[model samples]
Target chain A: MKKLSILVGVVVIVFGIALAMSFKSELCPYVTVSYVVSKGEVRNVQVNGTIVPNSTKILPNNTLMFNLSDGRTEMRVIYHGILSHYQEGIPAVVVGSYYNGIFHAREVLLKCPSKYKVAEENYSTSKVLSKG
Target chain B: MDIGYAFLVCSMLGILASIASSIAYLRGNDTRKIVKRANFAILTFTLLSFFTLLYYFLVRDFSVRYVFLYSDTHLPLVYTISAVWAGREGSLLLWLLYLSIFIVLSTRRLDKVTAFANAIMCIVAAFFNFLLLTSSNPFVRLSFHPPEGYGLNPLLRTPEMAIHPPAIFLGYAGMTVPFAFAIAATYYREEWVKRARNYLLVAWAFLGFGILLGAWWAYKTLGWGGYWGWDPVENSSLLPWLTASALLHGVIVEERKRGMKLLNYALAVVTFDLVILATFITRSGIISSVHAFARNKEAYAYMVLIALSLLLGFVVYIKRKDFFKCYHSYRLRERLIQGSVLIFALSTVTVLVGTLTPLLMHASVTRSFYRHIEIPLGTALVVLLGVCVVAYRESILRKSVLYSLAAGTLAGIVCFALTKLSLASLGVGIFVFSLAGVIQGYSSRKIDLRRAGAIAAHLGLILLFIGVMGSWMYESSYTNINMGVGQSVHAGDYTLKLNGFREVNGNAKFDVVAYVSVYRDGKLVGVLHPKLIIYNLMRSDRIVASVDIISLPLEDIYIAMGGVTPQGVASFEFYVVPLVSFVWIGSILIIAGGILAALQRREEKTRKGVVDAEGEG
Candidate 1:
């Protein structure tokens, strides 16, 4: 019984090591452009995109529909992040390589409308009117 | 100037003290001074670390990147405490603190036998504290400070999230006690093994409750109606649980029969080892589950080293001829040993292989490794479990083969008729077998409460299996047209009439409520109000499905609305699941049985003159 147990243990240990070794290389891969990066940095580029209402069920996290006007192509980007309200139809940049035929965006930034300018103008007008 | 560095230094000192004191105490040397110092150091370090993390969260210390990332000023007090464990570093620190606290508590009231136990506790504590200092230190200072921190994960903001990890950590860390006791028992005479059963029972209850709480949290929080997804993280938790459960039962046999001593010891060692391995798999990011931490090489190295040391220690203890000779041997014990080893071996293999297969498949050497290895291994596990059940029953019954076959066949037929399930459903078959095991207890005249609890647990498993199988196989789900107010849709045998959707705005979020009426077979069933909640900070949306369930003894009609489209149509999905309630019912029974088993009468003679000490070494 002891010998058999030992044999089983040895077999499992070997298999486990073999399994670990097999996955070691791919476990930590270099950040490539096409890997949809979420909330992290990649190579040096800062990429961003818009959250579009998706109809496909296969997209588990939902795809971000972005337009690349420079390239004149509509790009469907798959990203994993909590999409904010300003993220839709806002100018954004993605900082990753287009790898495996998909554009991977990392560190998304949403451009906000000029609410500060409007507030400043309103404050000045109110002060001038009060003086008059 | 930062609390992180101070906490780190304190923990490192605590680790040194624990190790030194443990060695001195175990050898019956002058360990009192060092042990006292270690106890105080551990308490001071843990309290300081905990409070510092809490302070970071409460103050919304954006200067500390971790706190800034996981907490915000707007976060509630409950979620603020939870944010302490929402990240990799903080979670590890929490584990360390909880383990140290438990060790200190357990060591305070120790008998002479508990000296060895205390030493083992100190060793385990030292391992964790060392891990804390070396890898994934929560006290690591931020390179740059930010004005405001990122908030916690929207999903983790649930109440269940607050309790799940802590409960799991308590259970995982609690297993160290029995492991320490096992090591301690090896030094003492055979009588210590009998006394260790009570401690083992306590550990078992903790681990079992923790696992259940986790499953409950997952079922409710994950938005997936089913529990037990067999995900790698879930499997890692279950692996220790399975071994611990088996060990709990085996200890009962050991205490009752004065047999299976070696088996009991082996179980103790393996259960402890599995706990470490589970922690490693989860924290080291060997598995790619959402719940697991991201890859951290230092954390991985620390875990591997700890795991290797524990493994080596276990191997040395088991292989030593003196250790075997210390306990009396029986020929009948061989079967139990074989069974235990087989189950343990199979579980270890299944978990290790299942967890690492994805990584292995992705490795450079296995560039062509396209197929999944876990499926075949899982199938093998199922087969082994089947064999174990048969063998266990055969050993107990010792009946004629013909009679056993006849009984099994009759039981199978009755189970089939009762369940009204086809043979194609393997899950149903397994559930039937579990039920049969429960019924088998009726004929055994030596029916005690513990045995009954065990039987109830088996019955619960059967119910759970049936529930999962029924929900998976026979469930009917379909999405209908998105409806407006006064719009109705047909789903399966039910027509869902959309009463209306009302949007309620709150202080921090807005909730879109969908009220719908269900009519099954032209008879009014009920109304369901599902909501789509939009949070303020992240502006993230979550669909909280409100299910109106018509539960029966054999089946359930569960209904939920997907939401109304802009076109004024309400979309609804109705699920007709068989034996769904039984799953939750079974889980509750299993938990209750575990509690009962934990409270089982301790062997009366073993409780004499046991001394409780103050503070663990």
Candidate 2:
């Protein structure tokens, strides 16, 4: 009985893993924003860049169009989701593919700018205090 | 500042003291005084270094690179304090400081294994101090002070952020106790397992609470209405916590029946190694993770060190394999309990494989992969819990099994009829049956704290399973909306209205607050104020979703703002999440169970101490 149970457990584990593999969704491979723009026909690739803030426009079918730039190259991205809490100049990672000069993003991930890098020193302490 | 010089000097002294204590222990001399003095010096020096960093942040000293990187002059006093560990270097220091304190506290027992444990802990502390002194030093001065400092992350400004990292670090540092005991068990004795068990429970509680807090923070702040993304960084933490949980259960079996000694020792080594792996993965840029801290060269060194540590642990296990030779077949209860632990261990392996697969391959595994493995394994674990609790009498076990089968079939039928989701229905049926069996077993006992804690914690799993099933399988989300002011939109049975908007400026941030009203069947439910706060200095905006929740006993109406237009057109997402509160309530019970178990152990220790003292007298 003990041996049988152990065998049963092994079989179940293998079956579960196989099932998971069958149901597994392919992850988008990481690529640069410039690379995505250069290729212009890549499918399901992850691109990271800074969001060009004022470029965000709400489109007709729950879709959003924005420009993402990596300091050197910029690409227009079409995302079909709620706008995440990110603004212009914040770095973000979008997973999708480029087609017809536009990247249709399946997912958008934003990195906490303050958490990941030092915030810029443009605004002075007095300006912040004045706002308060 | 001379403070850096002083901190380095004192840390150097701590290293000397630690080495001396280890040498004294190896020479078969009385290590009590050396261990005590070494632990004190290490704790004091680590505390001094921590405070020095805190002092820099408090004084807005941009001269210190870490200070300049994490804080600004306009930062609040409370946030300035939290800024101490907001960066990579400072967070490592925080881990080191916690480890120093853990060393001092855990060594106070002065058992026969003290020398060995102290030696192992000191070696661990030395490694951390070495990291602080060289590669990732927080005390490095900038070449020139900038005009203004960068502020802490706006998302991390929450109250939970201040406590979450420290709690998680304490748990990570606390696991060194069991690691040391594992080594000690290999060399000197196995009696230290009792002390090790207490520390394990405490560490498990801390880690569990930290994970819970992180989930809560993510749900509240991410504006993404869901929690537990199973991202690589999150998976890293869960990996070690799972192994440690398995170790917790395995240790009890070892203490009671001496069968799983080898397994428990291996778990300790694996748990500690996994913690290091977690740290390395999170800090190192090996994996592209949004949640990971910025990558640095120190990550490579960490990788090498972790590799060597794992190799060393493997060698030790190989050498001590003879000490834990199992001789006999286990009974049904013991087998069931051990099987459950093995199942948890298997789950950890599955998660680890999935996490590492992304690093090796071009693609990452989706959440569906983990869910596929966890659901059936989780169900099996829940069943094992019931079996272990009732396996004392064969007749009773058989009768209970039959009853559970009948009840489970009935519940499964009802569940399928209601939801038409077969897997979820099966899970619900098994959960209900297990819960009933556990409650019955508890009621029959005298209800000691240990039994009560174990039962409560186990039963909490049923609720958690139900909660996950209900929320994940049955929840509905509506994403797209453009609602103008005073406009009502229908979502399920509820009508949500965009009432109005207002502006508030305070604490160096400007908020655009949107008033959202909910109505059900022409009756007003509640109004939620979701604010968009944009900091003046940082220029980063955060969505402070008011989370207008209509809380029911078994379900919730969770609503939050997506974005708002300047012209009063707002986008809002509405969710009908069922039994989500049970997840939070179940986590509380799990933590309480751990604490109660620890308290029971303490009481037993006191009783034993008194008995030994009286007999000696």
- Top-DockQ structure, candidate number: 2
**Could you list the iRMS of every candidate?**
16.9, 8.9
* Model 2 alpha-carbon miss at residue B565, Å: 2.1
Off by over 4 Å in 2: A1-9, A12-16, A19-26, A31-45, A48-58, A66-77, A84-92, A97-103, A110-132, B109-112, B143-147, B283-286, B289-295, B414-424, B539-548, B602-617
Per-residue error (Å), model 1, residue B569: 4.4
lDDT of 2 by residue, B1-617 (tens): 45854775686677668667766766777776776887888888888888888888888889888888788787889988988877667777888888888888888866557667777787777777788788878888888988788767677788877777777777888888888877875766465577677788888888888878877776666554566767666778788889988987887667556678888887888888888877766544245432221234666676666776677677777776787886755667777777788788878977887777655654556677778777777778888876677775555888877777778789999989998989878887888788767866666655656667787788777788788877877788877756899898898878888888888978777787778787889988777676666775653433344445667898777777766766768887778788888888887788778777777756665565465335423
- B293-348: candidate 1 lDDT, tens digit per residue: 23345545555645764665576466653655425343333354445545555555
Model 2 residue B509 lDDT?
A: 77
Candidate 1's C-alpha lDDT?
0.57
Q: Model 2, DockQ value?
A: 0.21
Q: What are the RMSD figures for all models against the true structure?
A: 11.0, 5.9
Top candidate when judged by TM-score against the true structure: 2
